[model samples]
Target: MGKKKSKPAPLPQSLALPYTGVESHAHLDLPPFSSDIEEVLKRAKESGVRYICNVFLGHEAWKNNRHLFEQHDEVFFILGTHPSHVDQCTDAELGAMRAAFAEDSRLRGIGEIGLDYYWDHFPRENQKDIFIKQLHLAKELNTRVIIHSRDAAEDTIDVLETEGFVDYPVLWHCFGGDAELAERIVKNGWYLSIPGTVTYPKNEEAREALKVIPLDRMLIETDCPYLTPVPYRGKRNEPAYTVFTAECVAKELGIDTEELWTTCGNNAIRFFGL
Candidate 1:
């Protein structure tokens, strides 16, 4: 496909600059964050962030949020069988995800679910099976997948294509891979979401990969309250802080910050159906 020109759409003054409508991709269920969540969410919305794609790390995390999805217009959740949690679960448990998804239209997609061979917590076969099952769930639900792939690009891509996502939306959240693989994902029409990782000056590979990702297919995230970008690098990350990631991406793309912010905001909205 040809590269599309990065023409920015005009945004309202209130929604302008620094940025609004940022997306945070990660485990939002951690206990430390639960206490100040109302204040945290208020700040996020005030910052112009439209929504969060909170991924539950396991089935246990999934049970607490039946009302959380409905609590905020800007907070959305993804129900999936995480690769890390596969060892603790069974096929029956994974199957229940489909049932839960079927009952709740609020579920925008399936994922933070994919292969992660970097850790040996789950068996290779079990991870593969759960990944494929979740992909199948996405197909059945006619929604996209917020994928998580670490050191398993080939295996992840292989399963995605084989399971049949020729036209489905797949997002590689917190993407930290090479340019070649970045090109491959873009070529296949999958979207890539970057987090604060891009802000680190030492992360040249992520910077290079940013060059290959089309602005239309790129999304910004905090992946927090971890992977906080500079300034907040050592602090807890939240949705409001995702603007730093957009700033980093804008710098790399050689474009104005506001322009890049608008582009990423639109991409996140379109990708997550927010």
Candidate 2:
């Protein structure tokens, strides 16, 4: 008879941290969580995640699916056109987002916006143009700005600098670079949203980079339905997994896990104004 295959470990529930951790970024409105969002939110709350910032990739996504979290007050919103989808952006869509923000008290930020060179799915110039437009919108509305930069760090920073975003309330989301990059981001007076990718075994640079990131300047996230942390790395990610990322980050920084968790959580809450 063939031997039985081992089952994956169950979701973590014993981190013992207080209900103070915030999932700084996530995409719970995506299809992966469509069937189990209620359970996912419950698990997240049980894992001590106080709030979750659910990112809507663009105006249509926000318009169509913003109702998913209506019953869950702990979930907030960040709306913007992602780099890959910049081709779909139009003036009317931008205007709609502005109107929604004015009408929705839960709309806390304008983001998941920036350059994405990895896919090259859209024209880089167009991406930069839409990115600047959104940045200006964030400024006009005076809301938090969350950035999604991948393989386009230099241009991202350059555009932000040129747009007078230096020393502004910007968050470099899903940071996957070295300590040097971490230093540069914080040096520009911006925050870094560390995702579950940091928990991977081979990402030594990220682990080492955590040493230089100040406690108050970093936040944790699942970026889910993607970047699930180790032990749960191959599984579909959810907001409940933020604690595992926090655990890994705390160990690298040589601090108490609970302390690091709470500090990062507080940093997220204050930064996103949740």
Candidate 3:
């Protein structure tokens, strides 16, 4: 008799959404699994996270993934060229983004659109141009913004100040700056989004930065498919893992996780204008 074949090992449930809450931010477009977005989302909802703010940072996925937001009532999206993609963008592309966003109520904000000097591929001036343009568009639309700043915090803050966005709801997503920067940002009344990077043992700067962020201004994210939290580190992250980041944050504040979750969830609702 032929030997029986064992069934394929079950895929990890980490990508599945938990049943408890919502996820603040995730890049659902990148993957070894973008092709199976529906299945991934099904797992996400089954896991408990009821909604996700899917950030688009350029790719074929951006063009094709619009349907995912429409197909699922629980999903929302943001559009903009990422700092790294600034060089590849043209004026026409920016115009297109403005048009698309102007037409879609679900396309909530302009984002993933701050500065990064981490690599030299894109010139500083080019990143600034695109960043400022998108910021202006967001301001005109009276929409929220998701800023992506890495190694260019001062320049990023300068742009915001120059643009007179003193009252706009700007979220410094995946904030990893030191306490001083956090203090400055908090003074400006801007918000900070804590990612799984906050859970890493080596991110002392981010851990310290958390001290300055008041509870009302705090938001949570996974920046998923990257920055997976501990115990699940080196794995793909999803909304369910937001709870872990929330736990780390609560521990930092000496508050209970339930209180943190409720507060952060409320912050998210208000910031996203949901």
Among these predicted structures, which one has the highest TM-score?
A: 2
* Candidate 1 off by > 4 Å: 1-20
Model 2 TM: 0.97
**lDDT of each residue in 91-124, candidate 2, tens digit only:** 9889999998999889889988999999989889
Local distance difference test, per candidate?
0.77, 0.91, 0.79
Tens-digit lDDT string for candidate 1 (1-274): 9999865422222334653455748566787587887778777776667777787765567777555556776777787766877765566776777677777666788878898899857888889987887777678778888888888999999988888875578888888888999998998899998888887989999999989888888888887888888756787888777766776788888998778877888887887777
Q: Which stretches of candidate 3 lie over 4 Å from their true place?
A: 1-20, 59-61
Q: Residue 75 of model 3: what lDDT? A: 82
Question: Cα deviation of 50 in candidate 1 (Å)?
Answer: 1.5
Q: Report the number of backbone clashes for model 2.
A: 0
Question: Taking the tens digit of each residue's C-alpha lDDT, what string does model 3 give over 29-122?
Answer: 7765568778778776765566688887753446777766678888888888888988656777777777777677777778888988987458
What is the lDDT, from 0 to 100, of the residue 160 in candidate 2?
96
Poorest 10 consecutive residues of model 1 by lDDT? 7-16
TM-score of 1: 0.88
- RMSD (Cα, Å) for all candidates, in order, is 8.2, 1.5, 5.1
